[model samples]
Target: MANNSDIKRRDFVKTAGAVGAAAAAAARIQGAPAIQKVKAANNQVQYGMIGTGGRGQYLLRHLNSIDGGRCLAVCDIYRPNLEAAIKTSKDKPKGYLDYRELLARTDIDAVLIAVPLYLHFPITRDALLAGKHVFCEKSLVFKPEEVHALRALASSRPKQVLQVGLQRRYSKFYQTAKQMIEKGMLGNVTHVYAQWHRNPGWRMRQSPDPKRQREWNWRLFREFSGGLTAELASHQIDVATWMFGAEPEFVVGVGSLDTMKDGRDVYDNIQLIFNYPGGRKLMYSAISTNKHLSLFQGTRTEFGEVIMGTEGTIEITVGTDDEPAIGLWFYEPGPPKVEKAAGVKEKPVIAGATLATTGRGQIGLPILFERDLVTGKESFLARELKYARLWLYKRGIMVPEEDRNPVDVELDEFFQCCRTGARPKADLQVGLADSTAVILSNLAMDEGRRVYFSEIEKMGRTPEAKGRKA
Candidate 1:
């Protein structure tokens, strides 16, 4: 059904995609060594999980696949969650009501803290004091003081592995995107747009015991959570910061408790703009009314980021269980070049004329993975099969997937870091910066003004402010 020219064009595009994928793979390999899996039981990093709530159980599900870490205990005040966590662990870990009791165990070489935002600091501090490595979920600290305190404490214990649960750092697709940025594929990136939208987001679950309702729905309260900013936006903010290679100078935002008024103090919808250095900006939005995502041709929803630049744009999002992480590259057309007379200097073209000649919107190309890279080491049949798969991917017949989930990869890396005494990719500083963004963004919304990032140095430092909430 296809003409020879059409087949040749398809082959050319496929080959080009393959080359780009190989370059990305090579770049990532150059940045860091390949993750080595530990199979020996004697080398397993003994760890304890604190929290065992929904997030804790989710991590446990991923941890079950990683053999480098052995969960020795799980702690939670709620009996059901503790039991659920114990059941989830392949190691049949001991259950504890008090996280400190679990931290007290000399056998626990590391602690994975998945408690609510408020408890993250206290538990992490305790775990560090107990001489156990810690992997805490993000929006790493609750308040500004905790940010400084945790940084100081983690610095004091440099030998211990302190990783934040910002899993995009471990994602291959994200790594490739970063590599692309570094390689000048996306020239002079100046703006990023990100969103995590949901229709009727985060409903309050009724507890059998009415007294425990507030405690259970911690995310809905200002006391226990930073709301959507910490829970959702923190992740994307980290992505923007990572891409930009710097933190924002100032943040301005508006938030409202508009729709879901079930006694929750946190906002149901928020829109924010983070002004980074060099005139760059990250515009963000998280709404509860709509789940539409403008990324990936709207094939997906809920969350994604768009990085815009002079030469190209990247639309990306980390994958979930049902979907593979996707990164799409759209190349921007440069202004048409005018030929000058021989040995004559040419004047700059007018902006209006240049704008008219600049080309139309481009069809996006898939930012390929290592699997898509053709190293030319494969057998004849292997090469053919790889080509077939690439064709299928380009035709939307199939999607390219990461060899492992980023969540699983991050957890595995945490355990590996624990064993090797290596610094995690999402180290203490990265977590602290993310937390600072959360604190300032909330402050910006609460005060209804642009909040400068530098104010964090003096904030929560005074003795009087220690007792007060920011």
Candidate 2:
């Protein structure tokens, strides 16, 4: 037999589920664009891959399933990576030792760049100069001069599509979170806490040829890499900027090479605080010590973000292959209203002073997706399946999932933009802004001072200015 508590819990679940479904339905009614598929061979965007290393191969793996883009050529300085990229792509792309040789081919319409940080600008510039549309991975440029140069180059080629590899912009859950913020669901979002903590990060790899060791371990050196800021914090920093609807005004941070004393020049741990317009803040931390995450009841680890507001809070993170993306919402309870004492004319007396003194813990609610929402038009079986899934979700047995991975979505969108001349969500400007943050962040830590975003205008202007401290 069901007890009163069990009956009340079921009722609350039903009500909350209905509310979530209604929200989804409202979003649908507002005309959210459906995912598009490209099937025609002629309509496909013919593209080439440059720098077929780990990131390049990862993109190729996702690109294999994306019908909108077809890979024609792949290039890498290293022969093994080129071969691996060709094997990863279903299209059997032609492999090249020189990216220039691949770019010289007029048949290729666009190019995907996943080279190391130091090489990102030169290859992207060459590819653009070759009249190919470009999709470059994030921390788009290495130095401040590259930032100015790439912006100028991209602006000159107005017809060409230049997309950055920030996949979160393509995520549906992220989009929904933005909508919730706009709707004041998380009222007046003021602070965001983000972290990417890894245990024993970036092990050194031995190269067969001694000469290529530096090339293999480029990320460990400050000469080639911006280290943790460019590689890890860049993603979450973009998230904070996106959610805040403004760029950061200034940033101050501390970085240290405390662990992994194996000739690596970059910092192993970093903690930063960024101040945006309207006094909003984003606190970030990335460490090489542990992989524990406090969000989602410690069920996940490594990376996640917490957005806090006056009325509510949201804990969100992008998904991995083994786990789905999670967005947990918590509502802050309003303080109890003071009641006037019987027949008293003075200011309202506190109704139970003890009740108002204690903190009320909030229960987290799952942010529902489109599939979790039920329309009246669903078939009997479909509706029942949805209900069962909702029940499981409420019971913490299952979580909501995206219809497609954001990587595939971003790749498909890039191809679509190439074909249609549409602008990408993560365009050149977005990439530049992210890169600027990375550059300034490193400057702040190295110089031990607050670095202003406006300082980028003065940086890398003249040859001598590049070496000047902020």
Candidate 3:
């Protein structure tokens, strides 16, 4: 119930004081060892990009910033995107209207694909067949059949790496969170809540005909996109899957076009709960109604996750896609209970300070409640179990490295996988799992009933092939 200003003030104080605690978290993450340089090893990763639209261009800029990779070719149906990529990369390596032409470059180390969700499977498969590694974005495939096909393709080409653009998988904060989960820091984490609220859907480019313009937008149509599912909820769904260490067994949700009634066929709002194995569940919601956020640190409007457990809860966000993926952890398990017999003071102990008065004002960005940083190396798993209780006694906040970009990290990771045969964290299976969740959740919402994950499985490897479309 804190106002935005009040949230800001409270957060500023914590961040101002958390500088040391943040360092402790970082040092522990690096094993207090000398930072080894993991830059794309050989720099010989020559790459071409397909679907040179907004997303392609976004990655193009990042690819340029990376030290070793070179953009060898640009492909897009539209002239503008290809031209823009050409300009940004400053490499007149080659240009093609058809992606196949770009794929023909024998020297190209790999292909960076950023296309419509519908086309992910074909382009990625073709890229792999072309004997080039692939760095494709998620939802990996539009339908379920692509899932099995790509998995098979990847297996056949085990020598080459096929990575998806689910950058959070490469994030350090999330990496830390996953380690914490494995170590039982949250103590029986059983439920999670994730959301992404935006004011409006994608804006279409102006065109001669309005219908053509809509078609060009692609994201607003079922044929080209999965509405809020593939376009938005995919990330959080992956987060839930990753954090929980398992896929959901069942899902139920509701989708409505109540918010952005702009004549688009896809729903503008959706709410879903995924029941994972072992009684764990994920509560998710995405709406294009407002930009108001309820995310990490309880301070900023953001795209983040809250992992709830028995001993404590951690609220975190993926840091910039670049060198540092920042995340914060808060150890607030639940509300304080009342014991009337003997009146005693209940206060939050964080870092080394007792935060009794809510710090007067707002919570700021990059806020870390100091008490959260425990010696992660003491006994990796055992210490986290004990620290979860102690951390609930406090919290820790982390910030992004100056100018570090997630897009850059994703691009670099893709390139490295392409060049050195390194398997990426977000591989084909990971992306498909996320896409499958999107497809099934939408089905559950549309059918107005709970849907079993088995239903999706029974459909087929490629859900689309089985006639279950997203």
Candidate 1: deviation at residue 219, Å? 0.6
**Model 1 Cα displacement at 408 (Å)?**
0.7
* lDDT values for all models: 0.85, 0.84, 0.70
Name the runs in model 2 displaced over 4 angstroms.
Answer: 1-40, 342-356, 374-389, 463-470
Q: What overall lDDT, based on C-alpha atoms, would model 2 receive against the true structure?
A: 0.84
lDDT of 2 at 197: 96
lDDT of 1 by residue, 1-470 (tens): 11212122224235434543553365457642122233336799888898788899999998998878888898776777888998999999988876656765666788898988887876777667666788999989998888887887778667888999999999998999999999999999999999999999999989756866886788999988999999999999999999999999999999999999898999999999999999899999999999998778778999999999999999999999888899889888787787778999777877679667555776678888766777899899888998998888777777777889999989989988877888899999999999999999999999999999999987878765545434
lDDT of 2 by residue, 1-470 (tens): 11212122124235434543553465458742222223337789888998788899999998888878789899776667777888889999988765656766777888999988887887777666667889999989999888987887778778888999998898888888888899898889999999999998897889766765765788988988999999999999999999999999999999999988988899999999999999999999999999999999988999999999988899999987678899888987777798889998885677797677789676587887777779989999999999999888887788788889998889999988988889999999899999999999999999999999999988888866555533
Q: Is candidate 1 or candidate 3 better by TM-score?
A: 1
What's each prediction's TM-score? 0.85, 0.85, 0.75
What is the Å distance of residue 196 in model 2 from its true position?
Answer: 0.3
Model 2 scores a TM of: 0.85
Stretches > 4 Å off in candidate 3: 1-43, 208-211, 296-298, 319-326, 333-404, 460-470
lDDT ranking from best candidate downward: 1, 2, 3
Error of 3 at 271 (Å): 0.4
Model 3, range 1-470, lDDT digits (tens) per residue?
11212112124224323533443355457643121122333556777888788888887766767876777788776666667878878556567776656665576767888887777877776666666778888888887666666776678668777787887776556766788778876788899988887776565457544546665767887877888888778998999999888999999998888756666788888889999999899998887767676654345553678888886666776654433444545454345685656666666667856566454333322323223455555667776755565444233423433244555666777766665667778887788788789889888988999888777556654445457433
